[model samples]
Target: MAGFLELIDNTLGTHFHTPVYDPQTGRKKILRVIELASKQHNEGTTRAPNRSWAAGNNEGISFSPKIDGKPVLIGGKETNFVHKSRFQDFLKGLKAAVEKGDLDKEIKAALDGDAAPRASTSSSSGTRSGRNPLSNVRSSIGRSLGNGKSLEEAEATARANPKFDAAHIDQVVAEAKANAK
Candidate 1:
C-alpha cells in the first residue's frame, strides 16, 4: 500500500497525505471531510502578497466519502470511512470526478485556486499586469515532471526552480487537472 501511494505521488505529483493506518493502533485516523481536504491541499499561499485572501477556502466540500458501504451521507455533513479498504478506492473516485467535471461550486473554486474572497478593486484600474499568476508554479511543476528531460536531467533542472517541492508539485498538478476540464 505504501509503495502504491508513493507511485501515485511520484507519477501524478499529488499529496494524498492521509495517514491511513495509525502508528499505535494500526487503524486509520478518525478524519472528518474537512481534515482530509486540508491535509491534501491546505491554504497557505495567497493570490496577492499583501492580501489575506487565499484559494481553497471551501475545499472541505469536495470530500465525498462513502460510509457504511453507501455513497450517501446525511446533511451533507461530516462523516468517516471506518473500513480501511475503502479509502484508496474513494480517493480514486474523487480524482475521477474532478477530472470529469463532476464537482460542486466550492470544489470547483478550490480546484481552480480562486475560491478565496477577493477585495474590491478600484473602478479606474486600467493597467494590466504582465505576469501570469501561475507561470512560476507551472514552470516549477514542469521541471519536476521532467520537462522533456531524462530522469537524471529533470532532477537536475528541478533544483534550479526554487518553488519546487515534491508534495507541492503534486498539489499543483491536482489543481491543474481540476482546472483543465
Candidate 2:
C-alpha cells in the first residue's frame, strides 16, 4: 500500500494547459493535460497515463509492500516485485481475507505502532545544481579557435595534452564548428 500511495505522492506538480486540436471533430481546440503519471489535474481533462509494469530494482526482489511504516514479510523475507497479474491475484487474496476479518488482530497490532520514532529518509538526486559542463568546454574550444589555429593543429595539441580526453575531443571540436555555423 505504501508503494501505491508513494507513486501518487511523487507525481504532484502545477502545470499550464496546452491547447490541442480535437481529434474527433478536427475543427475545435481543446485543452489537453499531458501526463507523465498521476499528476496535476489542470482544468477538466481526466485520464490515466499509459505505462508498463516491470521489476522493482536490480537486486531481483519481488513486490515491496509496506503498511504502517513497516515492510510486509513473505516467507521470512521482505516482499519484492512480481508480475502485475500475480500482484493482482495477491490483492484479491487480501480482499477475501479482509471480508472475513482474518487480519483484524494483525491490523490492530499495526495501528498500535512501536513507541520509537522512525527516522525519515530523503533523496537528493533528479535536480540540477545550476552549473553546466558544456559552458566550460565550449569556452575553452572557442578561445583556441579564436587564436588562429587550424583544426588539425588544435587536434594535435589536444592529443599531446593528457588533460583532454581523446574520444570526447572530436565531439567537442564538431560542436564548436557547429556553433560557428
Candidate 3:
C-alpha cells in the first residue's frame, strides 16, 4: 500500500533522527506507522515483522500481513503480499547512529519516558572491530600468495589441508630439526 510505504518513509525520516536500542524499537515504530496507515487507507490488514527472515542475514527487516487469505492492495491493484523489506535502510541508518553514540541520548530519553520528536542532522562516524586471529593469519597467507582470494577462502584452504594444523606443522618442523642435528 502506498500509504503504508509513505508512513514507513515518514516514520523513518523522523525516528531515525534519534537513536534507539536493539533496532527493534525502530521496527516496532515502523509497524505502528504501517498500522496507522492501514487504518487511514481503510484496509483490514496488519503488518508485523517476520522473525524467521532474520535468521542468517546481517541486516534488513521483513514484514508479513496479519490477515490470512486476503490480497493487499497497492495503487488500486490487488496482489499477494508475501513479505516486505520495510526497514532495511532505516536499520543501516540506525547502525550508523549507534556507532556514533548519537543514540545514547535518544535511548536515555526513551528510557526516561519522554516522547519528544527527533531531529535530523548529518555528520556521524563509526568504528569496526578488529579481525579474528585466525582470520588475520588467513589474510596474511593470502597476501603472501599474491592471489586476490579472500581471508575466508585462505582459511578454508588451510583447514582442508591435512598437514596444515598448528600441532602438525610444529611436529614436522621439530622432526626436521632433529634429523639435521
Candidate 4:
C-alpha cells in the first residue's frame, strides 16, 4: 500500500491540509475561492500580469494561485513550473502555505492595494465635484431662464455647451420645458 501510494504520488502531487477556521464565527480566514489557472497569450510588459499555465502531458507549466481574485506573488514574480508533472505537488504546497498563514502578508498587501470597496461604482462622491452633476445642470438652466434669457436662447445655449452629455441635456431640457409651462 505504501509503494502503491508512492506511485500515485509520483504521478500526481499531494498537499495534505485543512483550512483553519475562526473559533467564534466559523469562517475561514480566506473567504474567497482558491483557483489555479494556466497561462495563455500574455502579450505585454511582464507578459500578462495575471497569466498562469498548466498543460496535459506538456512540460513547463506555470502556476499562479489566486485567492479572492488576487494572485499571491512570490518575490514579486508569478510562480511557474518546468516539470509539469509536479503540478499536484505544487498545488498541495500552496494549500499548506495558506493553512500555515505563510502567505498572509502578501495576501493582505494585495487586498489592501486593490481597495475593493472604493473601486466599486456604488460610491456617488468621487472624480466629479462632490455633488450630483444633474443638479448643476438644473441650476444652470434655472439661472439662464431667470436672467431674462428667452427659453429658446437658454435651450440653444444648453444644447451648444460641450461640457454636458446628451442625456443630461435632454433631462434638463425636459425639466425646463415643464417649469416654463
Give per-residue lDDT, candidate 2, residue 15: 33
Clashes counted in candidate 3 amount to: 0
Cand. 4 Cα-lDDT: 0.53
Clashes of each: 2, 5, 0, 5
Error of 4 at 81 (Å): 2.7
Off by over 4 Å in 4: 1-52, 56-58, 114-181
Model 1 has an lDDT value of 0.39
Q: lDDT of model 3 at residue 142?
A: 49
TM-score leaderboard ranking: 4, 2, 1, 3
Q: lDDT tens string, model 1, 1-181? A: 5677655546443546733432222112112332344344344322322221123333322333332222223234323332333434655565455444444433433334344333323323221123232444456556555445544444455445553455544566666567658
Which digits, one per residue and each the tens of the lDDT, describe model 4 over residues 91-144? Answer: 556656766777666666555444122323433322233446676566667778
Report the C-alpha lDDT of model 2 over 1-181, residue by residue, as the tens digit.
Answer: 5678656653344333534322322101001111211122222222323221223445232443334444333333334454533544554554455445554433333334322233422112111123233443444566566677876676666566554555556777887677768
Candidate that scores best on TM-score: 4
What value does the lDDT take at residue 161 in candidate 3? 55
Q: Which run of 10 residues does model 3 get worst, by summed lDDT?
A: 120-129
C-alpha lDDT (0 to 100) for residue 43 of candidate 3: 39
Q: How close is each model in CA RMSD to the real structure? A: 21.4, 20.8, 20.8, 19.9
